[model samples]
Target: MDMATTESTASTMSLASVTLEVADPEATHRFLTAFGVETYVRLRASQAPSTGFRGFTLALTVSRPATVDGFLDAAVNAGATVLKAAAKTLWGYGGVVQAPDGTIWKVATSAKKDTGPATREIDEVVLLLGVEDMKAGKQFYVDRGLPVAKSFGGKYTEFAAGDSSPVKLALYKRRGLAKDVGVPAEGAGSHRIVLGSTAESFTDPDGFAWEASTSSARP
Candidate 1:
């Protein structure tokens, strides 16, 4: 295959962290720590914390079906709510889980053809945002120097992240997203997601905040 661009030549947005506004940072901390998000926490600021499904996550792409099942099992033990049991899909084997903070996670094995044991659990993650306007939401990131890898008729769009990103990002229609999370569509606030960046902190069109990882950390 012809290499049009490398991760370097592709995009400039490499995520520094995936922040969530939550009801209990302590509970979130414990749940993520079990799954290996070494530095998850809540904000200690004059402003109150945000909670509920501001968005969700396209968590990891495992190597096999059993891996997805096993990882979800671990997530269940770690105070997660099973939104969907692991199973085979036209895309591949996948499932959904609600983290302690109500962050929905869609886990799948994209490399289903590869009959391998499995990669380490939670190898790669993608931040999935449910946007009121998918077109406007996608343009928001495109204007920020990020490129779109895939877009499906303003329904779903995936961004090609820079190499420094621990996980990629995507956007989906808010109503469709509620279905994916296996919950009724409800709640909106200042947004729980805080984008970890090296540049100046800001907010997205949907009110999600972006913070420089270094300056982002607060007690």
Candidate 2:
């Protein structure tokens, strides 16, 4: 991949992070840490602390604060459910939201700014597919001419397509992935996963559907 580029008038944006709720927070943290996030901080007490993500912070607490209520209202207006409300805590204010497909989001706010780095608005969407047969799916993508990045045994694999902006296309398989996304194992039919980009869809051998696209850039 070409890594060199000259700064131009056209603004460039890239994906910052894709947060997901897991059944086990500790395990999720460990997986992400091993997957390449350089730092991790567990929110605990009432004092606000800095998280590594830019423009975002995390706190641990029970009820919804006014600020969190406003945030929830915005999200609700946009069609999301308030899974949990933010409230004062030993650490700070925290809340949870349920996005489409049962995806849970943990939202927190703190007085400290831990803005780490400028994030590129997502250029592409990567759909991670969990399959009953990893080898077959891997071969399917390989035979289709998608570029393979790395394979963690037959358990995990990532691929890249030509539709590059910043985010690359990839797939992976793990136990309970389908359940986490609120889809049945047999319900992995072809469908679209929109991400403010060009829309593209693919169906793997195990009937698992994946989609990607580019849309309007985030402000």
Candidate 3:
């Protein structure tokens, strides 16, 4: 590879972590622990004014329908309000819940039926941001060095990340995403979530903030 190409590849940004800014960090931590995703995201206290939808949803993909139930039940029991009950769909079975701290979570599985008993195993964790413009959002991430892993016309886009990366990042249309998660598309103020990346800090076109990976590691 040429020197410039080598340097660019070496510095390509990767999602390192996700921090959910909440009102009560301790309570949110306890809730996450009960919901079996404490390690997937960190929490911090931020009283930023926000209302309606936060323009994003964090998703958990599991092995089977049963696993989806396990997560949904756990989250609901741990102070989450059910937005959508677990049900079978053309693609799979899934459900949506909003945590007490205002974060939306969706648990889903591609398998139509369970081959075994449910477990706490999670196959993937995805952070999906709802943006005003799909093409613009896709281009913004592309310009920042996030290679496209998958694209569905102008409706959705997913970015490639290292195998060890804690979270996968994706973009979707705001109104469509809100419909899928059972919320309204109108929201203002802070997104109340921060992304940690290997690249330098910058805000996306939709106002999603990214920070140096080290800052997210702080306690």
Candidate 4:
């Protein structure tokens, strides 16, 4: 069977894989921050003209609060920067960490009301991107051959959840994402993030980088 046929059982518009470019592919790949996310790091120099967020957050939804706290501590000890400490809120327990590769990870537990029990390591992750125009962004992705699993009120959108892989994807307004991290609406000169696919390389409406490749699989 062809690649599409193999991935058909996965979610619609599902990602074949996600790749991150770092100075050291071996080191970064060993620096596993979460599971269910496939990564390939290669030695690449600065291609962007400026330094700002390329536009995405690696969001991890764990099964329990302990997993949230444990992953936070483990990540920090592994050299990740603590952007936010785990706290109790309507969204359960969650915190943010900036991994060495400059990727922002939002780790959260949906226990709501309580920290819940300690749990195992993370085994699921979903990619969340920021777009300047939700309407236009949605249209852009939809036109790019990604099936829309859900798009509502222009506030949030998600691609078909890839069935075999736990690495799902979604998008939100860039401004809101910046605000969420207490950053400016517009970042500095260039972007730092690149989203990979199995076909071709292109830039999204907000300038996020995406390159097409041969095949994508969960590791």
- How many clashes does each candidate structure show, in the order listed? 1, 19, 0, 8
- For 1-219, candidate 4 gives per-residue lDDT tens digits of 112211112222446556665555555555663422334222343444545665677788887777787778877877788777888876577888777777678889787543466665565677878887888987777776676666665667777754434567788788777666545566665566555564567887777777664534223
Model 4 earns a TM-score of: 0.78
Error of 3 at 22 (Å): 0.4
Residues 1-219 of candidate 1: C-alpha lDDT, one tens digit per residue:
223322212455556666666666666667776765544333432234445555555567777887787678778899889988877777788889887666677778865555767555566677777788987987777777777777777688777766655678878887788787677777655555577875667777777777777755442
Error of 2 at 148 (Å): 0.7
lDDT of each: 0.68, 0.40, 0.87, 0.65
Select the stronger candidate by TM-score from 3 and 4.
3
lDDT (tens digit, per residue) of candidate 2 on 71-173: 4555455445665665544555556654332333344444223234322111223445556676887777665555566666665665543433333444445
In terms of TM-score, how similar is model 2 to the real structure? 0.39
Please give the lDDT score at residue 55 for candidate 1.
57
Clash pairs, model 1 backbone: 21-192
Better of 2 and 3 by TM-score: 3
TM-score of 1: 0.80
Q: Tell me, by TM-score, which candidate is best.
A: 3
Off by over 4 Å in 3: 1-11, 216-219
lDDT of 2: 0.40
